[model samples]
Target: MSEFETTGPERAGPERRPRVCVVGSGWRFTGGLSHYTCRLAGALADRSEVSALLMRRLLPRALYPGRARVGVKTAALDYDERVDVFDGVDWYWLPSLFGALRRLRRNRPDTVVFQWWTGTVAHTYLVLAAAARARGARVVVEFHEVQDTGEIRIPFVAAYTRRVLGALLRRSDAFLVHSEHDRQLLGDLFDLSGRPVTVVPHGPFDHYAVTHRPSPDGVFRLLFFGLIRPYKGLDVLIDAFHRLAPEEVSSFHLTVVGETWEGCTEPIEKIEASPYRDRITLVNRYVSDEEAKAHFAEADALVLPYRRSSASGPLHIAMSNGLPVVLSAVGGLVEAVGEYAGAVLVEPEDVPGLADGLRKARAAAGTRYPDPHTWQRNVEAILGRSAAAAEGGTR
Candidate 1:
């Protein structure tokens, strides 16, 4: 038997298991970062004493499945939990930054994991991580995407943000990145060498075991799933869909399945008023897990004409459900898409290229998706390395 299995139950002993805490906004809705945190926490919980500090904006039942699966402890803080929309993980809401810090100080976890994406939460996590380090706690920062010099438009703001990010990077003991593109950017932007930065690619759901029948198929279905934002390049997708020939339009239908974050709906509204109005469907609302599964199962292919993105959950979800994807070759997306037998990669913001990708994806539909075990193995290797590093072991 493997070392992990041989020790199995006995490995939970105090000397072996470390106290690990993950501090994040919350997990009441399905964001990529939130989902990533939950998955890691759940996986680690089986091997260590893992807890997550979440903002109180989640349903107790929705957030915490049960204490049986994982020893999940939740504390709710005074905040508009409604504003925090994440699901599938339990969160303890500490209302103010000070309250969060106080809780961390009280818990005194051995290792504190911080999830970072933007500047809004960077300083908050930096303070918490610093406090944890002051208490002799190890801090690890998991970056979904670090703003690149090319993607930053405002010079002064970008510089200031980079400075703040640098401070945070310097404070952490280790780093976790989703893609090689992100790892290179972290190293180049923050000088993050010699520090342990593990690359853990996200995993897809195993759809082969689940018997979910597709929706009645008269209309050709195309789905755009995830938070509707300008950076996601929905406008480019709409334009590309609009430019499709009438015959092609007749053979396909577009479904926009996600809520608008920055209230950017002008482009979508324009599409609604266009000549191909009847060919498109917009379910402009927060999609639940069931709804997401249904959409993926029913769709012919997932279209992600993202203008700028580091990684995508929708693409992973679609691929997991045995559906093919057509995404832009921007950021780490190319790495994630890899040379998968059942996926298509296109250039960023190229409407004709996107349309051609869509055409190709349709032509190559129903092929077997990439093996989920590949992603699982990647995740295992990263987590194992992170744990080993935390324990002062070599990679």
Candidate 2:
């Protein structure tokens, strides 16, 4: 079980490599999920046949936020498949959930890995799992968050969503959780003590290749990027930045660049209230890949002092950019950053500690990841035994 101790090849080839159906937003969105799905599918293709299943339309055009397309306008993926399922646009009563199920049954993939995130898709994914199970394909759900931040807003909705998700989880043959903390959280969320759960560390964001060609300049700078949400504890980060002595504050500039959502204005408010407001820049909107690259290139460190945490996608981005991180040692972050000399782990919401952590990172040299996670290693970890099982079937 210890990957560090393994001396031989990561995999023992199967007579027929187990075909995988990785279900997610193939190229449909531009964020952590789509990036993860696209890269993972590509990596799996290196060892086994891999296909990406995409939703034609997540929501009806009338209800869609920006554009009602199957893909992000700025991104593209090589693998994409359509599910001809009939869904009721008005309510969850439509049998369209079976569309993906039917597609999986027809394909009869060796394993179906469902991208498990958001309660909004719980009902559909629950039914999809049941359908996949009925058709005899091994089901694996990769959980991003054991729970979502928005869940607290609607307790009743969250309760029902959890019930539906629990059913799907019980029906799954295997599970892939990002870290041991997440594995434990999944158990707390639902009864997973009986399921085969593997701690597959999320790979670094290696897809930012052409866009990753610059290093931070002379001025000490800190960057925060991603969708802005309340649970991320940006206010605490801003307050901590304010707590730094005036001389230390003058030595650095903080860049807050990310898309903000409804009711997540506390960070913005904190920025405006700070005496060092002139030194802070906030781009409260969606950023392009080039823009993201530039931000990372110029940042001495990426700061993420979250209120609580799980496996952090932003942490992966920071590592891929080779920027040191000043992060709260909550959830899986402490383990994910794993002995990276550049990481400065601090107490969540501890104003003085966060300030000190940021100061330390200013003088710190970016460290290499002690255990660099790769999608190839992740795919192998999930499917190595399955591949051997596939070979046994041939025998």
Candidate 3:
């Protein structure tokens, strides 16, 4: 046998790797948080002793493999292994908060990472952070969407989220945000001076660089991929598509991928039954990874006309696949979708603005897409700083 074939796989030389535990809501499939967790775990696995504690409701066997080798301890609420994203991370299913606390205390991780977004895991995070702190473990809280616009009409839930998040933030050792806007929001909302904050841009997927078969014809295909929520501004996209001339409409197509949430389907159904039906394609369901790739492959550009302000994972996915984006200037969308040659920014919730953006995006189609290097560099900087801190180094 060749030397490569004869030798066992090369092992990372041991230097007392720091134990790191990642806590998150769910990790079943290809949503934003799941993708972020998987990527972060993979990146840290190469250098540190990494494990993940996922919620039982979202555990998938397929999603997590090689857990035994990687020391993944999955904690779920049930006995089912129906949800798994990838392998190589340890898992503990249906584990109580107290059980998780005991495990953390026993493992004595060097750092405990928490991923927060919808506030579902808020109480658990607070308890875990306290547990980790008692053991001298550094706590890192990564805010997927921390900015509270204070525009939420639901006062009770908003108030509860604010109170819980404030407590979580105050207890965390370090805060990781996706944009400067989020950093500023953190500073405004909580006492964050003592706990340093770092900005890390979302990274592109590995498959983004894969060779994709282009759409057979040169029709300008506009794609809206992700969960169909009211805030996504689908109404604006529909209005913009409707305003196109007959010939223009015939020459273009809009594909709405992913299912509707938050009563967004009513308007979508109205659009589907209207005169502009033929100009649009509604693949209204949770898009699989393969399906998403095919849609991106067949599209000329991705349109993200969100009404409310927040960062977007779809924008990063689109840009990573070399699909230029036309996005509304709201919250961190502008920061994430920088003014690259392939990006077009427009006013939020303006039908005419979206229409004009569409025109410009179509006009700019076939141009070189934005470089992913910036995202890579930003992620590296964040991880580097985190690693340095873990190793007793300065920022």
TM-scores of the candidates are 0.77, 0.84, 0.80
Candidate 1 global TM-score: 0.77
Comparison by TM-score, 1 against 3, better one = 3
Candidate 1, residues 1-395, lDDT tens digits: the string is: 21112121222333665566766655333355555565556555654566666543333343322212222322122223212122212223344555666666665566777777655455566677778877777677777778632336667757777888889888877776667777777787777658767666655543222333554665557889877777888888888887889988887888888776555787678667878989788887665556666677678788888877777878777766666788888988877777466678888999999988888877865555754423444334333533332211222
Question: What lDDT score is found at residue 361 in candidate 2?
Answer: 87
Ranking by TM-score: 2, 3, 1
In order, what is each prediction's RMSD in angstroms?
A: 8.2, 6.1, 9.2
What TM-score number comes out for model 3?
0.80
Candidate ordering by lDDT (highest first): 2, 3, 1
Kindly give the stretch of ten consecutive residues in candidate 3 with the minimal lDDT sum. 2-11
Q: Where does candidate 2 stray beyond 4 Å?
A: 1-14, 26-29, 59-72, 76-102, 209-217, 365-371, 386-395
Candidate 2 per-residue lDDT, tens place, 246-348, comes to 9878778899987766578888988888899998999987766667767776777889988777777778877776677999989878777774666889998
lDDT over C-alpha atoms for residue 49 of model 1: 60
Worst 10 residues of 2 by lDDT: 386-395
Query: Each model's C-alpha lDDT?
Result: 0.63, 0.68, 0.64
Tell me the tens digit of each residue's lDDT in model 3 across 1-395: 21101011221224565566767645333356666666666566655566666543333344322222122332121212322222222233243555676667666666677877764456666777887777776677878777333224468857777898888777776766766777777778787756567666665554444454555677788999877777888878888777787877776788888766555676577676757787788887675566677788778889998886557777877777777788888877767766455788889888888888888888877765755434343333334433332211222
lDDT score, candidate 1, position 371: 41
